[model samples]
Target: MEKKCVNEKKCGSCKYLHMTYKEQLKKKEEFVKHELEKCPELKGHFKPIIGMENPWNYRNKVTAVFDRDRKGNPISGVYQEGTHRVIPVEKCLIEDELADKIIGTIRGMLRSFKIKVYDEDTGYGLLRYVLVRRGFATGEVMVVLVTASPIFPSKRNFTNALLKAHPEITTVVQNVNNRTDSLILGDKQQILYGKGYIEDILCGCRFRISPASFYQINPVQTEKLYSKAVELAGLSGKETVIDAYCGIGTIGLIASKHAKNVISVELNPDAVRDAIVNAKVNGIKNVRFYKADAGRFLTQMAEEGAKADVLLMDPPRNGSSEEFLRSAALLGPGKIVYISCNPVSLGRDLGVLKKLGYRAEECWMVDMFPWTAHVETAVLLVRKP
Candidate 1:
């Protein structure tokens, strides 16, 4: 069965969508294998890649960039593959269906309002982007209207009109980005309607997700990936756990049941706040969230002679920095479960950890983003005696 996306060439987001899903998994497995081969020490520890049962419409979030169509009418869609050119995405196979619908509805509303979209060349406009995020399990929705400026004409009428059109929308926020740069959202934000946040259930825990919160786009695969990481950690209800680069404390809070305590470190304060609220919502008392640099926090822990039995790190796609790996070595966790988005970065970081008395013992690849050339993996590392 072919996927539902039509703009494959114009919107090159789905690079591997041409092949069958099985073939996609095979190719991804080979890619991870080749990346791991760069690190000869853990070359043989690669396990069979975990795939999704049904990969369609998995993303909980979607964003539409504002651009003018050839007809000079304001349009919104994704950027073309490897180009700044806007390729209007009417639908996406990977994004949640409701999110796509809401985005379309917003675009229609913008057109109806005659709202001038920010032109990158002219720099005079109101809306820059429309970001729609839906709670996969909660049925809640949040719409972030990214504008070039905070001053929105007829704001109240526009809000009323949008809410009237889409009664399912739970919240609406306006993010102002006055700069000409390509950044989607600015630091200044105002809640135009509702509570300005949404909640979702992941791994049997409730999480509060804001516009800035780093919740996983693919919630279903994220549960599988995090579960694999927790299982790899081998938590025994007696060991302390440390979650480095823990975004909103998803991994750490989920692992709280199996561990005596979990200390999650994040650089984003907004995420840390959400993590704390999520902990309270889940009734998870054993976990604590700290807003600090993960590397610096780990370094401080090492200096204080503090140690954790289990360390779980889910770094960004660029991968872990050498300072983070160095801090991890100094922390000296008995077991380290690394959840990585990029295999090449994982390979590079593993080479660094190998010199620090840590070796990869088990590895599992989870197909988080199907149809895309992205792969997520969890690896268990044990300190050499």
Candidate 2:
């Protein structure tokens, strides 16, 4: 099929926009297969999961950086690749309609308040970016205003104006990002209106997400991914399961129905607290959350003769670290479900597991991030005698 870039050379989000969806999927599948081939032991077991039909407009949330135009009017959108030039986005195809509306409202609010755009050189600006997250099931919305400093009186008035304007918003948070160079949230957060956090339901469990917490951006695909992970774990009523990197304990909570005991390990204390609250609200006592580094906890467990029948991992985009993978392999769980967003790193880590005498029993590909070059994969590895 012929391929063309919609916003060719303008939008930096998709470098492969010039390629057709079919061609993009094909390229991604080939890339995954080749990476797996790097480990001869995984050559026969590697499988390609099918890509999604509608890849565009799949993202549930979008974080748009703010800048000012030549006229000194605030421009709200993403920056051009490798440069700080602001690209005003009238309609982002990747986000939902609510996200677009939130962006439009924020732009209007900035204009109405005459807010100054933060300059990278001077490091002065009231507004930095607007983040919007939508709940698929409840139609609830959360608007997060990221700024270089605390909201001024005028900006606070602007936030009040927004809440009065849009009642759909369930949570409005102002994140203070004073650091000169960083993409993360600042040391403090002030709740401007309503609840400080929003609720998202996954696999029949409700999870409260703060601005800094990490949750899946794509709700529909995440549900499918979590369901698949639970299935691959093959949870039995008598089995003990360990969910590593259990962000908010979504996987562990879902798997609790089938497993007798679930131990969820997360490095972030805030996430761990949220996980515990989620478990309590859901009337689930079988799940326990530990606020510790995943790799270190697994290594300690291995040294202490602690073992789990099933081990489930949903690591970050970089995939699991070498130490974590080696520790997991040494634990010698009956089954290991490794979920990853980056195929290259997943393949690399799978090679390490192969040397530890584990074989990839099954592989599934999920088009979690469609339209772009990213894909989510899940592999179930079993220890071989």
Best by lDDT: 1
- 1-385, model 2: which lDDT tens digit per residue? 4345445476777766767777777777777777777556565665666666566666767788888888878787777777778788867666787788878888887766877778887887788888888777777788888888885657568877887778788888888888887484776788888788778898899887777777888888888889998998888799889999998888899999999999999998878888999999899999989999999999999888887889999988888888888888777788999999988898888888888888887877777776677888888888888
lDDT of 1 by residue, 1-385 (tens): 7865678878877888889999999999999888877556666788888888998999888989988888977777898877788888777888888888877777787776778888887788788899999988989999999988888988889988888978989999998889867678789999999999999998898999999889999988898898889999988899999998988888899999899999999998889999999999889999988899888899888889888888999998899888888888888898899899999999988888888999788889999999999999898899999
Off by over 4 Å in 2: 1-8, 39-48
Compared with the true structure, all predictions reach lDDT values of 0.88, 0.81
* Clashes by residue pair, model 1: none
Which ten-residue region of model 2 has the weakest summed lDDT?
Answer: 1-10
**Cα lDDT over the full model 2:** 0.81
Question: Against the hidden reference, what TM-scores do the models get?
Answer: 0.97, 0.93
Model 1 alpha-carbon drift over 4 Å, by segment = 39-44
